[model samples]
Target: MVSEIHLSDDLGDSNLTVSDFANTLDAAIRTLLEEQSTGLIAGGKISNKLVELEIPEKLVVIGDIHGDLRALHNILKKIKIDKFVLNHNNKIIFLGDYVDRGLGSIEVLYTICSLKIQHPHSVVLMRGNHEAPVEFPISSHDLPKRMTERFGRRIGTEIYQTKIMDLFHLLYLITIIKGELFLVHGGVPTDLSNITMKFNEIVPNETGLFGDMLEEILWNDPRILPDGKDWENSRRGLGKHFSSNVSKNWLSISKTKVIVRGHEPCNGFKLDHDGMVLTLFSCNEAYPKFSVGYISTSGIRLHSIRNGFDLSEMVKIL
Candidate 1:
């Protein structure tokens, strides 16, 4: 049997101090930086902002927490994360957007950081559009304001700039599970003609197309158009709205069957591109009408799965 680790009981604790939160962020950032420098994470290789993993025995995917501490706690409890990670072959991937729009942003981030620090190899934290503001600033960004409300002006602003921003910079942009699945916060890259380049070889911060690819990976969404158009400017004003053909071409070029992402709000989960893409929305507090959901599956099952529609049976709704 694998040794079990204990998680903190104060997930959404009301009395968490600024110092504690800062310390947790500091530890998580250090771990991520080390992973980047060494190019190793959870027995997988890291290339720039992409993580390449040879499918784990079990994988749990959580999407867009958005400061929903209760939802996070519920998912963790439902999955029995502490016990699950004990198996060593079990992994959990958080699909980013961990902050903003909810009252418990700090608490939610604190819990996630603590989890990452405890099980560095078992947890993968991917960057979402909300976390992309460090490079591509969003006008409606409110994580700093949430921090200020929680810890007062000076301390909150200090921590947000020093620790939180550093953490965001260290978050992974994409995680590819070998020949099985392509996991990202948003949708597929629009320019599939040049997508023959391996994802691991692409540098996110490089100028020109590489930079644009990073932006699209973090901000893009999927839509089915009546016309034959494959790409269009996104209303969000950052990434493009890619059509079903875009997803198919991208998946075929990347040698992956499905694109699992978290961006659009839906009733827990939604399938796009004729079941070629799976969009998971895991927080109810951010959009109360939508139910929170996550994907829990074994790599064997995921690898054998045909498309997103068949994968829906594995989603656990909260």
Candidate 2:
């Protein structure tokens, strides 16, 4: 049975004061920094921008929110996340891209951050490419502009620099559900051999190999063509487009069955690389032609699942 989770009425409302917004951003930044310093431990352990956990009994997997506060709210209500967390063993993973491309980026960030503060153990926030500009700058970035428009120049600029940028640096890069699944904002690195070694102790802004790996995790996308090369230069200009064989080999190396990510816009969700990759797009406002959806299932069921095609059956489309 699902119980009701009452969200703040002012979350997406214009009535929310600038001071309140700043305070929430500050509180969230503090929470993330503290988590970074001390490590986050619920059932899983998060350290060095990587989250590792045993598959929970029940799990809710959300994709790119892209500032859709209504979508986020709907998912939370539909999943009964507040009630689900009461079990302590259940978890929810947000596959990044939380802000940008929509009108309510500030509200979306605030809501997720508030959820993290309220249920530190039950919620995991991963970093998306939209959240990667502090390191790998992208030309299409509009978050700063959105902030300035919403809160005015001086205060908004300060918030984006001090509060949001700091918070972005602290978001987790990837989450591993032990041998069950690999969750990231984008796609896998082309070189699977170095993954285990590099991901063990990753620094978000490091140069050379680690930097390259970070870029791929945040910007890459899976190549859907069956005959495509193992790796091809992505049209996105930053990450490589990996083929099905790469996905298979990477999964074998990581000991995970499926790669779950969110960087592409599709109708609800998409399966690529022979169902080895699941790309979920959960915001309709960003791509009006695309449907929004998320995955809600037990970790046990995920462990038994062989591919994204099978997993698609569990998606809850809104």
Candidate 3:
């Protein structure tokens, strides 16, 4: 029979204190990291600790970075991106899941945090479902176990530092740009009221499973838009495509303005239904795979998204 949630009660000497966890977990992670070259893992562990950067022009948005630092860095160097959005307010909203499934999550967070510091007012960093503890359930193959299996205690402890925990606390952070555009990591929750509230109210841990209304807000996939205006849920994976129906619904709930988001990967940067919404995935499969995406809301003629990430017909954007 399969093991039944073998999570340990100890979590080693982490930077941030988790409520409950076993101790051996840190030892395992340290062993793994050492066996696999602790030096490199140590470098990656600190990648997401950046400080400052240039301001964005108008706005720039990125998608699931998935720890691909090479790809992320390449895109940053090539994009000549502006970090601030002045008139219509240009900013970069990382759709979510900045870490895992790849490498370099540390760097991705550092750059994002760096941008946050540089363009404090213009930088609108939001959270993805991956930020939720649920994403790292004891059953995960790469996390907890693989992470523990590699990366040793020192590196693992950093993963739970004040920086990461703080980010998780506000994982559901959002911004209703111009009171029209609702900028978020995933799709707006099925419960429209949740979106109407502040960012922390929808944070999973902070509010727990109470009347907080986060399961859907932080977890709902946009692909499950109502079919034929039926308002039904689709079986798309958590990485569901944002349906035109969802766009329509979000528009109505937020007053028929454009809804820009990042969750599922498109060819690269794409604009649908006459610029009503846009998606700019920053990471690309090529270039150490850093080809990232962004949006430019300048000139105010129509919303335009920019990116170094490309589409090779591998993704399905239902």
Best by lDDT: 1
Question: How does residue 170 of candidate 2 score in lDDT?
Answer: 76
lDDT of 1: 0.81
| lDDT (Cα) of model 2 | 0.80
- Total residue pair clashes for candidate 1: 0
Ranking by TM-score: 1, 2, 3
Reference-based TM-score, model 3: 0.58
* TM-score on alpha carbons, each prediction: 0.92, 0.90, 0.58
Clash totals, every prediction: 0, 0, 44
The 10-residue segment of model 3 with minimum total lDDT is: 42-51
User: Model 3 over residues 198-227: C-alpha lDDT tens digits?
Assistant: 333432232433243343444444443445
Clashing pairs in 1: none
lDDT tens digits, residue span 1-60, model 2: 111234654554555567777777777677777776776567787667878888898998
Local distance difference test scores for all models = 0.81, 0.80, 0.44
Off by over 4 Å in 2: 1-12, 192-196, 199-209, 224-228
On a 0 to 1 TM-score scale, where does candidate 2 land against the true structure? Answer: 0.90
TM-score of 1: 0.92
* lDDT ranking, best first: 1, 2, 3
